[model samples]
Target: AQSPLALRQNILSTLGRTMLEEGVWTFPFTRWIKLIASELSAYRDAAPPDEQQSLRYLTPQDIHEEIKHSGLLRYGDTRTRVEFAHHTYQEFYAALALKNQVDDIEPYVDTPEARRRWQGVIVLLYGITTDRVKLYSQILGYSNDYARIWLAAQCLANAGEDIPTALSRLQEALVPSQQFALLFSVGLACRQLGRYPEALTYLLKAAEENPASAEVQFELGALYRQVDQFERAIFHLEEAIRLRSDFVDVYNQLGLTYYDQEKYEEALTVFRATTQLEPHNPYHYYNVGTVQKILRDYEGARESFRMALKLKPDYIEAKTQLDMLEKALSTGVVQMLEKIPMLSKMTLEQSVLLANRIQVKEYQPGQIVFHMGEMGDTFYIIEVGEVEVLAPEMGRSSGGVINRLGPGNFFGEIALLRAVPRTATIRATKPTRLLAISRDDFSAVLSRYPAIAHRLAETSSLRLLRDRQIGRRVDLDRYYDPGYIAELTRQDRVTVLMGDIHGSTYLTNAIGPELMVAFLDEYLLRMSSIIVQAGGAMDKSLGDSVMGVFGSNPDVPGDESLPVKAALLAALRMREEYVILRDKWKQQSPEFAHSGMGIGISTGKVRTGTVGAEATMVGPAVNMASKLSKLAIKGRTESEVYIDGVTRQLAGDSFATEPLDPAYTKKKVGVELEAYRLIRQK
Candidate 1:
């Protein structure tokens, strides 16, 4: 029988020939990487447990050293080889770490005993030292290990550069269990570099491998937040907190989720718990304080602020709160004294002291303190029980109560702001206690508390905006400046590639072309409407596919990045539309049923210009976008949308992506092509 090396050599030679004939360089690189992998495996198998250290290559850096000796970097720049090495190492390390083999890791931090045990591992984990640098440089002087060099190139890619080219060179790299981690890191870097959709793809890969990872869930949460999907944010954040209870910041974030839903009491409870967990965290205190204020617990709010200041003395928020409390207290007092008509003859200074001592008055049901339209100098609060403001004469015989004002709830304060008659009749729903603040006293309090004055102003403004009743869907063409798209795209470029359903001739033959056309027409119109309303512009429609651009300024700001984002936003909207439409149509017509369009999005610089006759304008980037879309349409990839490295960089924390092998597809453009797939939690 031939030796293992001989057998491997035979396999390598055969594989190499096949790859060369196929014109796929990745195949050859893969074979080489695998051969090296086999050798390392053999070394591991033969070495005794205790004696393994002599030849032990546990960490990625050890592998890097071996590869450096084998001359892998000779084929490319040291930078590229270093990157590949890092990528390979990270893939392995992350996997090992996930398995809780931290014992195998050397102490990367400065320590005594740690340095003696896992020197190579520690150095690689923490990064280059002077001695380590010298060692690697010496190894590079000679031809390094080809396998390790490839790994180094991958590492460089993880560090913050393009790894696809190097990955293409080493196609046969082992798929470690930590593949998700490597992909996630790569996706994150891509996002930092302005590749939003690409990051979404790579991070999605990470999410798939470790569906329970808090990091991945948090990432999905962030993406949903950007798209204003508050419900989705709640879902992801809840999951993240569930998975990792000690995530620390997630507690406050969860609180915000509740707050956004208008579950004020729930939000307050969440924030209170967060403050308890992170007592020293000033922000938590601030959040709790805000919620307390909203709930009308003036004393409780003051105490929360004081606690916040105690934790951090320079807290501007806490100081601001103090000023507001003082104003409210003074105003309550002055308003009380001014309310008593018998005390109208009292001097201002005496009135001030007397007002400060007035206690809140309790009212019984049907007790009339003052009737509607009667002159009154005071506002009322439900100090103990419930009160109702009724529009008695407004159509109904009795009247409709606008709100249930309960204990701690205040009303009639606006009466102090404006000297208008009561807008509605006020009556006690149950036994109620009231505190009054007269207009003159309120003004005097404002003079003392500037911060409170500002708070009151902000509250008033917020109320006005809320009551304005603007419709949900605003016309982007009118109020939104076309140039704003360019600005948004420049800040965050996204991409969208679209593909139409093909090979439906068989389906149509079975179901009739009229049915097929009807189905397609309905879906296309529904999807188009959805995408456009979501602020995406259709780039063009090619039969079954509609390519669209996001972040594009119709007003012609001429920003190159905008078109790509416009495309991506459109794609997302189309995807959502497809889900609903598919369910409805499938319910109605099973034979003529159809899957949604395939989309591919790669973010990067592509020429955007008008082509065609004077009567028509077309964009070439639209042509480039067909690569991923066509791939999806042909079922060449599992991913519905394939994004590129560039798009991943743009999306950042908002979305994640997965790097994929070059996807192949046949279309008007033709042939196999490299593409990245975008991934995010549904």
Candidate 2:
């Protein structure tokens, strides 16, 4: 009931505030407001109650024209926030936004991030898309909702109402095997609702359906633990731990299960391992001490309590326990230092001294410990869980785990002791604990322990040899799109890895046609395997050179870096395989000993597609890589790898690079290409 004069003044104040807020850094306010309005209208009209709402539909492009013709919405100075000039402006024009409703909800609902982007505002406010319920309920009237039912079941779990009915629908829609995600959701809900028997039934069914899911196993383990089924609980929890090593909650729960069963020693072992896996977790150390004290491992308990207190000084429980253990420590207690495999060989005095400095490092699943080419000043020994070793091939990683290491195994020492860069990437495949010893400390220890030092050398050398021989055969039928056809071309970002044999001509002349042909066939077979295994599309084999394509379908939603990484990995593998081939050929036919390979990689974008029956990926990336390979071929003594600036930038930090002289490609008239010799994956 404001007077007209007062309303005018209020409007002016709002306008001033809007301008001040948006003036700091300007955006297209008019455009933003129109888009927001359009989005809001769709949500409001899609309400399940049905069909009374009307809107003045405006496509995003029609906003400019609508604002120009209408008086309700005013466009102020460019820096001002967009606003309804009149109070009723939005109410009158909201009919404008009704996107064509999707018939199938599976695509929208399958991907959570996409669903959030499309329906987040509505979902956050309503918790369920009301119309989605209307649409889904309508779908149930038909013969089957199929894949779509699972999506609705997922949404129903979020709504946390009508779960029973949704569960029934999901069960009908699901096919056989490990793809029923809704089963896990239902199982977890049942467990939370305190229906242990029902939870057990659904979870056991889920595990049978999808044994690979770590979440399901964890839930199953938790349910078993709740029911006092220790044997079943341990089995499932251990499986969960193996599937995802960094699932920290599972570790604590597993330890508690052991404790509840009065398996004090087993509980102590588990908690100790948990503390090592999650060193910064005060609760983990406290749990360790709890079990240690119960087992009367008083000295170990004292150390555990002290560590807990170190991580959290205000820890009352840890402090109290430490006081009790401190009194017991006067009599001296046994340390767990002798249990460490590497230090098990060391003298008690030496082991104790080193164990004091032995800090625990933890990594989650898929987390990189250290990338290839980083400086190494620490050696790591796996204390718990597992890690995968990934070695880069060409100029990038092939994205395949080359080797796996478990507890008691160690790595990074070759680089630490030899004063070289990290040779490969080490990534945790599961929640993992590693004990790290600094180079300085390890070297000092080694100086005292000659036998252990000699063993270290032997281990590193053997590992290095194994790493070099790790690249296996690749089958090419998987990647190439031979059926590709059309005039429809798209701008494609591509990675190109080109390789040329270094001494094919000399070998051909030296060994004669018969032996030379056998060598060429062997070389091609091995190189092709390397390329395909590293995730490259086999493009073609020129007389003496090979070319591979990556990011063939750039328009697809995928990792932007995949192409470059794949191309690089393939090239490195090809080089390695070629060396082995060359050595074999030299031994068999000494006359043709000059065989070698040179590889080059580059990444860029170009128009690419199939032309008639021929597939083509011609562009700057392909051209540059070819030229770089030729540049690599100039190295008479050794096989070499060269990469362009773009490839280097995308490959990320940690490379052992030597800048090459600025060189000209024959095709480029005046421009000199800047390049670097990628010696090896550090």
Candidate 3:
């Protein structure tokens, strides 16, 4: 048997002679056969008689037989045309044909179209050819196109040859403006060649040249990972993510690095976040499930796997994992329930009897397990994961998280014992598993053991009282006077203002939930008052952000400039109020010192109407304001306000402003948005 490389070389030599002679990689079947035969005949005639007999020349019949057996070539769209089975096959042979004819490669590298067509062949030639000096010199001479120069640097690094001299010469040949591209290309090439230390040096230099480049950060992160420097890998990867939040590949690499370090919870968080960013991607869901399984959150893993299978029915790995999870859960439910403290009160025989009556149920994250006011007939015990108890008015999407119950906790007992409606909503904050017992089973158990009923009744009364208190705390109507509901309408143009607290995640982690809630309450109350006083209608309050619209009230008619001025005034007041709030909070805790606010204002046409039962403002202006708010926070350290050019123009000289750097703005905003910083009233 011939080695794979020898066979490949033999096939290339046979077809490459015809390909080079004809100056084409593709040819008609009969034309290809004729060329091959002609080349073979010439070689046969030139050989000595004794050697010629030993050289077995193939006939047309034999050539046709070889085409049928050889897997290296295949027919094109039309059966009459034949070409290499893969483009790489053709590229290798073309490189081989050009090995000695070094001058013939220039036409293929001088222009964008030519480079794209022969890029593979050129790189392959750099690897197999003995005359590296000539190829390197020829490529660098075409300095007019930096793309070609970069390509040559990449080819040299990838060829595993000593490239410091060539790289130095290329860098010297290029202008300063083009140095970053050369450095980045060489660094990435070094990375691909597994030269991590050298790759790091070049990439760090490239990053110094263009610090905000997400591409550079990503390369550095990946290079750091290759060297097992996980912390550095995480730092650069997160920086890349902060620069470009939509970078899914960076998120995956960060999550994988976390997994390698045995930080399963952190990995789960990253993978779960990717799922939110790309919900339709089955692989993201699969990755989330894999990490959740390692964390021992079996129910969460099972739900994630099921979601992956749901998105792609033929996902074999997801299907297999789901099957295995279900089997394990079915076999272990009895043992799992037996370990519960509540069940431990019963005798072993009684425990077995109750466990036999229990059924296992699973819920996905954000899934509503049950709603308030629904008649409940089952008692649930938390077997794994967590669920949130929300008051009726808090609903599903808002700040309704009153209480969270994790593994070994239980709920729904009041409904089961009292035969009444559920007092509050139950939502799974993460994938959750619950062991449920029907009212009938509970009744049967109570009949056998009356003492259990008395204990349940006492627990139910306390829970019912707590639920009422929670309901009262969250009810919006009790705290504010009733206001007129604005009629649903659309406005031709409006000024939309969006603002959010910066460093909210850090604040939440540092001060805990209770204090965070108090902080948000104080922040939103002052901000909303400012917006309303400025003649803007409150649009929505989502977590840490608030959106308000000016010129949206149909009852009031005014000049376009009126709304712009009002929106700007509200933004300025909000920023000033945030400074005071931050100062007061800083006195209480050092963590609040870093906290700030960002506001974005945009003026354009918007549709202000009701969607279902909720009022909304929908338009490019609304989206722009939200994105600008995020950009403001990401771009600055202190509290700042950014307004679109339209708003600035309408405000005229009424407000002092400074235009943002065009390049920096473009990089952060990813659009042609001319934004200005609102300084103060002129």
Number of colliding residue pairs in each model: 72, 16, 0
Best-fitting candidate, measured by TM-score?
3
Counting only residues 3 or more apart in sequence or on different chains, how many pairs clash (N, Cα, C under 3 Å) in candidate 1? 72
Q: Estimate each model's TM-score.
A: 0.31, 0.30, 0.38
C-alpha lDDT (0 to 100) for residue 211 of candidate 1? 88
| Local accuracy of candidate 1 as per-residue lDDT tens digits, 615-635 | 111233345566656554334
lDDT of 3 at 461: 42
Ranking by TM-score: 3, 1, 2
Give the Cα error of residue 318 in candidate 2, in Å: 2.9
Winner on lDDT between 1 and 2 is 2
RMSD of each: 35.0, 35.4, 25.9
For model 2, how does the per-residue alpha-carbon lDDT over 41-66 read when each residue is reduced to its tens digit?
55446544433232234343354345
* Predicted structure 1: lDDT: 0.51
Across residues 98-204, which tens digit of lDDT does each residue of candidate 3 receive? 77444656777777777777788788888987766567656655332446756766787668656576578666766666677777767767776777778899889
RMSD of 1: 35.0
Give the winner by lDDT: 3
- The better candidate by TM-score, 2 or 3, is 3
Displacement of residue 668 (Cα, Å) in model 3 is 76
